[model samples]
Target: MQTIHINRAEEMYDHPPIALAVGFFDGIHLGHLTVISKMIEVAEVNKLKKAVMTFDPHPSVVLNPEKKRTDYLTPLNEKRRIFEKLGVDYLFIVPFTSKFAAMSEKDFIRDYLTDNHVKEVIAGFDFTYGKYGKGNMLKLAEDRDGFNVTTVSKKALNDEKVSTTEIRRMLMDGEVEEANAQLGRPYKISGLVVQGEKRGRTIGFPTANVMPDEDYVMPKLGVYAVTLKQLSTGETFKGVCNIGYKPTFHDPSKSAVSIEVHIFDFHDSIYGERVEVFWHEFLRPEQKFSGIDALIAQINQDKVKAEQILRDMEL
Candidate 1:
């Protein structure tokens, strides 16, 4: 997909008229996919390019500046990858600024829709835009400058709306299966392996300490079954990941949470290598163990369970 950063809508005027799916699409969950799929269907039928537009730094970053950090379920790069995989023709990233946030509803429509030659727009029923978010699907359809408007109803599973916020909540609560179902895939986090104190190695379970690449919403502090892949080589391994403060060996209050994955049957020193971990299941919460022997025994049990989980998943 061609990624374009839009400061002004005129920047997209030269391109072919596009059927656009516009949203923040943080996790690209099922609900977001419904909107995007509608865009793709419309674009194909109308012979328009498949396009998606998203805002950077999030609208909350500009509208509510006091919130220091906003974590994303899918970062920009990951979003681009997923969009490309879905066969999007163009991906527009608009910088969310205070000035941009202040743009009137009519001005926003004219600039981003009419000026850019948008053939149609696909948005969720709850989608809003313009100053103070006064622009709704009803308003967009009523304006009808040139482009058509499509509103996708809420997508849900088990009566729960499939949404990014819900996915983030599930991850933070250690509900990987539910999050994965909403996402239509496993929950993944990409990062580079970093050096550790070799504590796991001392206990015969060497681990790769991962440092995440972006502002990702982290999972609950616990032990999990996961599959780890070396991004460059495409070699995947079954693993048990522990996200915790190493309470068994250190004080939880004084330590930062760490992500350490013990790859099954692998002993290579992979410090500095990039890897992505796909979360499968939550095994147990992190806790302080009595001694080294107890810790090792528990880890052995974790490895066995992780192996079985991964095997069943593969089957």
Candidate 2:
């Protein structure tokens, strides 16, 4: 998708009239696909450009600073990648600021709709906007004239609604397989491999430590079967990852959580290199062992299990 950062409504007029889908679309899961698919259908029928309207620094982060910042499932870059893959023609990343937050429902429609020649607008059934999220789909449809407004109902899985929040909950619980099913892809985090303490090397399992970008959401603290992709080489390798402090080495209070992975039969200093790790299966929870001997034993066992799982995978 052609990504455009929008600071004002007037800028939108430069583009051709379009049919738009609007949402934060944190994970771009199946539910989001439902809305995006409908938007594409509307654009095709109306002979208009297909576009998506999304916000950065999610409004919640700006409107309520007191609340803890939640990590995004699909960060801006990844979201744009997904949009491109979905065949969206345009993506407007509106900067979420106090002024934008204060806009009224009518002003938003007037500025983004009337001025930009938006042929049709699409959003999820629970979509809200305007100051303090006071605008609802019903209100927008009632206020707008001469524009088609479509609201897609929530998509469900096994009777439960499929949502970004639900998928996040699954990830936080280390249910990687279930989360991947909901996402329609493996749960991935992209980051740079940085230098670590080299403790894993001493244990006979050298690791590449990845420090994810600030906006990337991390999975739960545990061991997982993962696939590592080197961006520069476009090479993928089976791996095992640990997302937690080295509890068996240092005091729990003094240690910090780290993401370290050991790619099978792979050896190279990947420090300062960017990589994408796709979490495929949850192997076990993080635990503190009695000593290095016990931890090494567990690590070996985990590697065997992870290797078997990767071999059995269809990927």
Identify the candidate with maximal TM-score.
Answer: 1
Kindly provide the TM-score of model 2 when superposed on the true structure, using C-alpha atoms: 0.95
CA lDDT of every candidate: 0.91, 0.89
lDDT of 2 by residue, 195-231 (tens): 9999899889999999987577778899999999999
What RMSD does model 2 have?
A: 1.6
How far out, in Å, is residue 288 in model 1? Answer: 1.3
> Residue 125 in candidate 1 has what lDDT?
94
Per model, state how many residue pairs clash: 0, 0
Please list the residue runs of candidate 2 whose C-alpha ends up more than 4 Å from where it truly belongs after superposition.
66-68
Clashing pairs in 2: none
